[model samples]
Target: MSLFAGMAMDEESVKAGKLQIANYKLGENVHLFGGAFYLCYQKGLINWLTDWNPDVLIMEANPRYIATPSAVKWMHARGRKVIGWGLGAPPSNSPHFLQKWGKRQRGVFLSQFDALISYSQRGADEYAALGFPREKIFVAHNSVAPAPTFQVSRPKFHEKPSIIFVGRLQARKRVNWLIRACAEMGSKPRLVIVGDGPEREKLELLANEIYPATEFVGAKHGAELTPYFAEADLFVLPGTGGLAVQEAMAHGLPVIVAKGDGTQDDLVRAGNGWQIPPEDYGALVQVTREALSDASRVGRMGEESLRIVTEEINIEKMVASFVRALNSLRY
Candidate 1:
């Protein structure tokens, strides 16, 4: 399989794996709203498709990409299929008029695809709400990596529960909220903040002042990150973006993820962990304290997290879902 991606925005940076695949870097990204809303149209997309001549084309389901409609048209003209894959429906973060315009444009763009794939069921429902055929929408449950093969075992309890947050330290991540909650906890847990971003300096300042015990480990990944997950008693994401939730679960760590993207609706279920309102500080502290209160309960919850990653969610399952959706389109 081949992929077309652009390396324009800082957020677009990716970790290249060992797998060999045709990866075309196309487009000059134009960042607006400080990289929040940007557009990257692959000017050579049509020529690339003509040369590669794939039977099916899977692409981001975003209206911002001006070349996508043309690509969809080119694929359809050859009796080939195309799939629109993305987080979900058009974001309503803009003004009312712009939101309506964006939604309408997205509806038209998605209507051309043979099938649609969302990262979560909530996303699928959002697509359906936008007048897309619900039956053609599939959920891949966005996965970060494979389930862990090694056993993730921990003592019945630590003298102090180690709470971990693994992701970029950005304002939206709300790592500050996590630090605040950890500081307010009656039984002060060892809060470990992993990953770095523009918000790192400010977050470190806050951590030092209130939660002096908070550990800022900068950024760790792959093998370097495994130990933190293995050693931690609980994983918490106080902000948005849940790609780290499954990773935490794979390591058998129960998660406390604030509901951000709809993806959390499927991953963080009842038995495994708790999902709180994105900005509810009181709920964050309360649920976290509860999760760490009973040692046996935390252990059972961790087991459930492992089970979810093993059976229900993972990169393997996500790929299977994509295959099922794509194969169905072929027939």
Candidate 2:
């Protein structure tokens, strides 16, 4: 059976609900409808599920509120199997305690489903680490619509060859490391940030005082970020995994990401982008300087980055893998 489960997917940045709904429609072989705590404001989802009575209760990511056993109970009570779908990252390689906890929480929430969906091989391993049997795991990559063919022109900006960083401005994101790296850049490459967070005010001051070339463009979302992506010679994130790293790569911008499990680890490879070990400020600074000094190398890296996404990673692959996993469940 087929189903469409919704959740708080309208939030800015990354929203899983919209992605899930699209996947459900694409995989129309089974019944589809809202399930568990759908983000849709209309109440009585329980009644809605009870009424439609599909073969499965489908969802993306880790379930919230009615996670695992409770959600499993809810669906089973209605004579339907609960099929959890979405990416799950392993915590084995992470140094962050919070990341480990969050991973564990997702594992607990996902374990109750008849089967779990994973966007990448790394995500599938997270489930295995949680003691989930191979039969209970589904592995799939997310997918996206094909982008228009661009001649890959710069966004009509000056050729400053700036080092750009995007994503939320938070300590966990480790944006400060980029700022510190800029200070160490003896040639003084322009360091530009295209996001905002609680660390904004402090980061702004820190940039102005310590690294004069550093600039923060407040918060740019959706289309506003394209120009930066188009103009940047290299993108760096001193933090963990984020879909943005893939977004950067999609835009033909190579990323210098912190080494660890996340979306970045999947994108940054040997010759495409740099993945320095976590908290390696000196190495971060050195890599930034080296990449900035060679304009040709930087451009080639950007092209390679885009190639990585188009060739190996796309939202469509991710979504398809997830749907296949959901459909393979015995329950």
List the RMSD of every prediction in angstroms.
2.6, 7.5
N/CA/C clash count, model 2: 19
For candidate 2, write residues 180-287 as lDDT tens digits: 888877666678898877788888888778887788888787678888777677889887655577777778886788876444546578678888888778888888
lDDT of 1 by residue, 48-84 (tens): 7887889899998887787888999999899999999
Best by lDDT: 1
The lDDT of each candidate is 0.85, 0.67
Worst 10 residues of 2 by lDDT: 22-31
Candidate 2 at 299: error in angstroms?
2.5
Worst 10 residues of 1 by lDDT: 25-34
The superposed Cα distance between candidate 1 and the true structure at residue 230, in angstroms, equals 2.1
